[model samples]
Target: MAALVPFSLLRNYSPFMLARPFIVKGCNLNFSKSVLPLPCRRLPFSARATHDEQAAAKAAAATADSGAPTIFDKIINKEIPSSIVYEDEKVLAFRDINPQAPVHVLVIPKVRDGLTELAKAEARHGEILGQLLYAARIVAEKEGILDGFRVVLNSGPSACQSVYHLHLHVLGGRQMNWPPG
Candidate 1:
């Protein structure tokens, strides 16, 4: 296994590495963008504090809580350059900023259309929903994960859906466990 690096190491490393976000497993290590503060003192990854209260506060502060614009809009508008995997008039597929597996991509719709989360979907959203799922397949194929893949859609805060925008996580390239945590 690759050795786990510390987020603080970026401060001493080159500036270029600090400018971009990278992930190990599903945890986001972007210090600049992280809402959960990293410990300044020496502590192992497992020993670091898990602030459930702080996490809850951050989730409550989610932008556009009532179905308004989210950061995904910026990616779709090309304002924020993403590592796009697949794109079309109706859907967009890009690598997850925080990946869960060797092959992890996020498939989302070009237009949210009130679909802030999968649980918000209505009859009118059926077509676009299908398109998003199909786009996940395209991403899986491009990433060469045809043997197996897991498509995950986190619908609410309880499911750890941090961003309010609807997204389908296409994860593969590893043996996934049942009864997902």
Candidate 2:
């Protein structure tokens, strides 16, 4: 273990003591250092979104609803086209139309059973919820992202849930960032 020197002592030491290369007895020691990037002075956002984008964002956040049918119903009933990834008697897994990642799939229960959102889930929903999560894993396996995948549930408007139906988004195929937006 390297010796621990107080930071105050660093200021008093010669500039040669704090260097990328510190030599001792004709032997050069290479020590790498990480320098944090300086804080940006620019605005937090690059540009303002257009009216349509703002409206869409608002709509995405307006799904704090219940006991309502959404587009997922049509997809479930085969009334609409969806690329089915995995399916069983209880749960259905399909590819997301607007995918956030290369391997993106949506998992949901065949019957809503009043489970419009995760926050509204009750004890009766335990079995189906487990099935949905299992189906998500099956989707990950089929999509070749079983090694690293994410299961996401947007419960309400604050979570950016556009559809009122309860569904899990299985995303993978790249490095996911921390503190997801």
Task: Measure candidate 2: CA RMSD.
Answer: 13.2
Alpha-carbon shift of residue 118 in model 2 (angstroms)? 0.5
Q: For each candidate, how many residue pairs have backbone atoms clashing (under 3 Å)?
A: 0, 0
| Residue-level lDDT tens digits of model 2 in 111-166 | 98888889989999999998988888888888899899999998776665667788
Give me candidate 1's TM-score against the actual structure. Answer: 0.69
- In order, the Cα lDDT scores of the candidates are 0.73, 0.72
Per-residue lDDT over 113-172 for candidate 1, one digit per residue giving the tens place of the 0 to 100 score: 888888888999999999988898889889999889999998776676777778899999
How well does model 2 score by local distance difference test? 0.72
Highest TM-score model number: 1
What lDDT does candidate 1 reach at residue 121? 87
